[model samples]
Target: MNLLEKGDDKDIEALSGLGIVSDDKSTITKSTIVEVELDLELEETLKKFGLRLESDGCLNWQMDASAHPRNWSVSRRAFNTSVLLALDLYTTAISTSGPSMAQAAMKEMDLGHIKSLIAFSSMYQFGQALGGVVFPPYSECFGRKAVYIATTLIYCLACVLTAEVPTMTGVCVGRFICGIMSAVPSVVVEGSIEDLFNMKSRVWIIFLWACATTAGLVLGPIYGAYISAYCGWKWVLFTGAIVTGVFTLLLLFIRESRPSRLLAQQAARLQHEKGLSYPIHSADATPNLATFSRIALIRPLRLFFTEPIVFVCSLMMAVSWALIYLFAESLPSVYASLGFTGPSTSLAFIPLLLGIPLSILFRIHDQRVLGRRECANLALNPEQKLTGFVIAAPALAVGLWIFAWTVPPAVPHLHWAVSMIGLVLVGFATNEFACTLSGYLADSYTIYASSAFAALAFLRAILAGVFPLFAPRMYSAMGQNLASTVLAAVATCFCGAALLFMKYGKTVRQKSKFAGHSLVVNRATQVKGDNVE
Candidate 1:
């Protein structure tokens, strides 16, 4: 009954000359692999034909590697190019500026109202959260490249529909579709960097990715301003479509990075060398897709209930994200209160622009000093990364408090600049902490990375959606200072909760089924390195 015993796992190419022992259904042990090593001469021949063997005992033959120099060539240019397009699409299509323009257009059509606008925006976030559940799982089930292409196509289609939508409800539908499709780029950014570099060097790539995302936030308003001013709101959607189309075409050359899938392909080639006509796949090896049961659908939800660390960190980051969106959304009203029209509203993003460079500097410091120290702790213990957030917690609190007190009539443009600088600092630190947390989770629990990330994304989106709907009302009711003070208190509570875990987080991780075993293994590796080779 052993699957391997029946040669179901044998590479089809490897069985080309080897006769089939048994093809009967019951005689075979379902989808199992057969192990067979090729002779040195056969291996050499396979290499000549551009093939590689995997541990699953199969052959994966493909075209020559050099035949696709462009595929393997990973320059900063190519990475940045893809990154820029993805970010532009995300920022231009999803940011407050984009929606505000669409709202204006809808109002001109007599269909705009606060409830509908809020619902539409909330749905966008909800769609994103829902997509986090679906797309990441599907990407892990399939491969990153395929998912990227599919999402890009979907996004393009949605944008076309959005631009031409006749009613507010249709607009909401289009935006929700666009939001769902938008989930892939963030996932792809992490995957792409992992494909290209090792951990030590990945910090820079992360920095670049973060900056690109921030730049989109700044530039979205600027471009949205111009588009909304000159051509109308439809051009906002139109511009996104044109840019996304070009990027989708560029995606024709992207390579896959899913390790299990790549390993399967290699196994197929190894089987080819053994003359097997059909190579067996080892899907059971991957934790993410090993079980195709209903339980798998709710794994992330299970994680939410069980993993306190994931819950706290994701909640903190989600609150911060919502606040960022709230600030961005209200900027127009703030400017209008001060008598600025459409063009000048775009100029307001200059503060955000100035803040980004400053944030990058802080992020660089956090990575070089704090991140290294924490990651090294991971080799010894899992809780070390949580310490890095200690610095971030206060930075966020102070920045928010200062920004709250300094807004409007009391201070001036300089105060606004300082507030932005403060916000950028907190944003950068929060981003760094979240990124490192995710990386640590991935390193410690490699198999559960997609689901864990999906869980975080889902929660963050839910919070982000709800927070924005209440933001204007909260500010109106409580005033900016009081609302910010309240948010600061909430953030402080998170910090306090985070600190408690930082003190005991390793013990906590060591108790969880998902993390405990990995912690021991990683610690063993470090101890082994210290004692032996």
Candidate 2:
């Protein structure tokens, strides 16, 4: 009963014709390569690299060949990662920068209220949610390189529209489009990581990515503030355009990282050249766009509802993300009450960055915990990452409570410094929770981690979109302490999810369609001096 068991993914359904091709072989073993007819030139090329054509007609890299992405030179890997990370940061920053211009746009457009802000801010998030539904599976079908180029181009176009559009209506439209393209990094970047990095190395690489993601969010307000102050609101988008447009060109150089699609292409090339037909690897099927849409769009929603782990973790993450946006929208008022006004409010977001440094400390503590417990995360040990979640969970609650009590406009409001301290704690908690939960999902649903995360992205994006719309009203109704307390209670409630998983996650996985009969059970798993069984 693997938890993430999937049926014939519609992602590949449309490609059955091309994938099966004029000659189809369902099973090809290593020993059968001798019987297959291979192009002489292709054969020569393989030999030159000390590789060979496999019976499956795929390019079989030799043990030491540089053709394997894993074996790519250090410079190549570093260059590729840098390009991908840069693209991710630029795209995400564009999505959040809209708020820096919210007031300016409202004035320029002659709109009086904050409601239209949703049209740009939340709509962009809505687009991001929708993007998650489509892009991850597209990566599985078309390869990461194609998806990156296509999505980045669309994102850059959206930035142009936002910058140049004369009407508020047009800017709102551009924001949604930008948000959709922004999702490409969130949904597909993890799949790219899977393509290049091995298990042991993935943790720290993901840590790097997490930091990059937070950096983008941190950049949004500051970058937008400076641009809006100096050059007006429209120029804020132009700044993103200038940055992302450069990154988009850089995207052209990132080589195909999807192993399945790469091998399929190599095999297809050889077959056409030699007029020889052989079985291809099963994973390389390229489903038609319609089937791809059906599966890609539907799968995340299905997983969001049906998978308990996805449901709980997504809820937790949704709450976290929604809170971040809600706080952003409310920042102007909060600090205004404390006598901080205008663009300086953007600097308030700096506290959110403390999470990056604090997370490094947590990662060190987490690694030490895993080592002392002799825990093998590969052995379906979802609980291995739960410690940080546990520690951070209460901190999130306390932080919310503190913010509620300390933020201005309440009778005898506490110092601004005190409220900021609460923000620091929330930021730290958010980083720890997201990293640990994401790592757990990646480990538990190894094959379907993308979909699991897509569910997370989709749900959180929606929450992030919707929550800010009501944040101001909610604050006005309940005041800071009561409103913060309600939010804190919500955060505290989900913390039980981590506790429950810590106790029963193993037993639940024992019965999962994807993780049941664990492939990893053969490996030793121990914690607290006893073998995990």
Candidate 3:
């Protein structure tokens, strides 16, 4: 039947502009007429609520949409990003702070064995592994602001428990809870910042975030040593609680940044304002248990095992993370052997701090080169992002070898400064390796980048947590030189990962079901299909 013929002149006039009616008053298919009518109604409804529909009939941000986070002013976005960055720094700092206060904790609680001391750090990392998998989905379900506030508050309480509780078990329990809450910042903050900036603008912001996180690892032990030495180890926990409490208050000023949550809120407001009871659908429906299970738990684990890129990246990152913890465990003994005592032992870690800035400078230079290449119309791929990693991998192996030989019996007369130089190399390589690989993963996975990263975080946190538990014993039994040599050898073997990926990454991605399609291409295809429809 001809659908437009039944409509009044006003309806036909409206339909004519939409091309649902012909100038010759030709017959229009029922399906086409119905679809146009439906689109018009949706558009009218959205317009009434200060929202709009794109050509694809999907709700989208208006031009310069004030409500869209990306359209927020530079100062506003930077302020919010700074808050998240602070949280990231604090969480990472606390992760390593345990080893700094371990001796004080053991003496105060009457704990036996160095393993018991290491547990303070180990348990927190274990909780982080589980929480990394768990919290990201909840943030997806709720808004990022709510998750950040609630977790920060809980973390404060956990810190208080750790500080105040006299029993070893009580402190360990608090540390574990703290780890779980801290995982939100580690895994979700980057995603939050992503909500604030587009792909082209966010690279430097991510770099800053990486620097803050890595700085926390080096700074934690240094400050924890001084804080524990003077104010007592309990004060270390107390300080964390105080800082977190301040940030929790600051969180109140941060608005909801998650797009789905913001859209849902707008929809609810529209329904209320129009005196309508019918549901207004949003892009992200409220996730149910099954959806949550699939996104949060199942998908990450599946990708981790099935994807070669994921496996290799996760393993390499895991080892790098473990090396940081291993250094925390072994550095004290190494320096003490050379007659350093008290906070002086912490001085050895200062060289590690130099690596982060050096790495950042190197990355800045690499980025400029890449920018020039792109400007010259050179084709860039995910493998191209691994250039820094390729350069850094050999340095890591060499650094480990240098440290292995320069310490104690291997080259007994070698100045401690030379060993410190090796540490400088190690620190630089570790930071570069982690940051570059993270970028590569994000590029390769695109739409599923979060899931891929969650997988990486899960495995990395678990292995990082476990490595410290045995580090003391391993260093003792194997001796510093031999054990470090073994580590260097492992690093040397993994150096091939950079070469392998750079050479064959595209071929590998082609075989993978998940990574076979680029997000940009998929989106373009979807938009084209919508236009055709």
Please tell me which predicted candidate would have the highest TM-score against the true structure: 3
| Worst 10 contiguous positions by lDDT, candidate 1 | 524-533
Best-fitting candidate, measured by lDDT? 3
- Pairs that collide in candidate 3 are none
Cα lDDT tens digits, model 2, 1-533, are 22211342332232344353222233333233322323455667666544565664545545454555656777887788888877877676666675667766777777644656676678889999988878887777777887788888888788889778757678778988888888888767876765665444556666677777767766677777778887988887776777778877888988887665665666566567655455544343556888776666676677778777778888887788677777767776777787787788877788887755687876776667656555544322457657778877888888888877887666465668888887888887777777777776666655456777888999888888888778788878887668787988898786677789899877766666544422242121110121223
Candidate 3, which ten residues in sequence have the lowest lDDT sum?
524-533
Q: State the C-alpha lDDT per candidate.
A: 0.58, 0.70, 0.75
lDDT of 3 by residue, 1-533 (tens): 65545455565566678666775554555576568777778767776554665455445444455676777788888889999999888878878777877866677677765655545788888888888877765665667898899999999999999878867788779888998898888877766755676543444676677778778877777777888898998888888999999999999998888766776677678668765433432433456878777655666787889999999999997798778877877888888877789877887888888987776675676567657666776644656567778878998899899889898866777788888888888888888876777777766665455567778889878877877777788988998899899989999987888899989988898788777654443343221111100
Candidates arranged by TM-score, highest first: 3, 2, 1
Per-candidate TM equals 0.76, 0.83, 0.86
Tell me how candidate 1 scores on lDDT: 0.58
Encode model 1's per-residue lDDT on 1-533: one tens digit a residue. Answer: 54334454445433443554444435443343233233456557656645544456554433333222223445633664464346534643355454456445756667544555554466667777887777665666666777777787788888789778746777778878877877667544554454344344444555555556556655666766678788887777887778778777767666676544664665555456655443433332434554644555576677767887667656776676566556556666555545568667656666555544544554465456645554566333334444456666776777677666666644544434555565565555555555456555554443455666677778877766676667678877887667777877776665676577668776666677766653443333221121100
